[model samples]
Target: MPPKPSKPMMCNRKALPVAAKLKLIRKLEKGTSVAKLCEEYGVAQYCVNATASKSGKGLPRKHMKTARETGLDAAVLKWYVQERSVGINVHGVEIMSAANRLVHM
Candidate 1:
């Protein structure tokens, strides 16, 4: 018997960016239909509804941490910029080494 070909899978999951969410909210305010918006954005109707309901709230910064961590982040960023400006190819291991050196200083 010959092998059968498998059917293609269709996945509809999507994560909309903040700007796109804001655009969807605006369109909703302008009386655009949810079905139409869903079709246009390739998102589910529930996503559009959720975006409309959560329009004005600010998105939290996932990378942000305490003051000490922020200071470390700034120091590492400065080191990275300096290294790059001097024609150095900064790799991940080198970055980690610089961060560790900065931490102990």
Candidate 2:
């Protein structure tokens, strides 16, 4: 028997830009059917429907959080740069030690 075709994979977070997502959102808000959108955009119905439902919650695919998102990590990075600029003998151990201290406090 011939093999059945597999469904396309769900979009990865990076697959669609914010602008594209917003456009889809706008179309959904304007009463376009999710099935129509799914067919047009080649995306799953859930992607269009979820964005349609979360009009106020937040952007659906915010970039993943990173160290900068945590205030402590940003502060530590700034401190590391400043110390190096002053010719202080900063080492990896010292940086990690400081980070551990700040995290514990």
Candidate 3:
């Protein structure tokens, strides 16, 4: 039988960073054992699979998405990120306004 994780090992955490996930996946591709990787990285098997799946996406994954988050306009999110990269600090209200324009449905 698999050993039970300790109580401390069950502590809740934010989603692990993509870079860290990618690194773990890279190690796996290079022949590292999953059990050893999980132990070394303080993650579970679920995390390993999720990380691998998310690594190949064209978009970044958003963690803990709320029920109220359904109305997002992707173009606004993309433009917001691009503008931010060029040093623009956009507010939520601004994104909403822009989202309205981009969301034709």
In the range 3-81, model 2's lDDT, one tens digit per residue, is 9999767565425567888898888777887788787787776667666666753346556766743888887898899
Largest lDDT belongs to which candidate? 1
Q: All models: lDDT?
A: 0.80, 0.75, 0.72
How do these models rank on TM-score, best leading?
1, 3, 2
Record all residue pairs in model 1 with backbone atoms less than 3 Å apart, i.e. clashing. none
lDDT per residue for candidate 3 within 1-105, as digits (tens), equals 999886555435536777887778898778887788877788786666667666663234556756444456456778898989999889989887887777654
Off by over 4 Å in 1: 1-12, 56-105
Pick by TM-score: which candidate is best?
Answer: 1
Over 4 Å off, model 3 = 1-8, 12-14, 56-105
Cα TM-score of candidate 2: 0.39
TM-score of 3: 0.40
Give every collision pair in model 2.
none
Q: Lowest summed-lDDT stretch of 10 residues in model 2?
A: 54-63
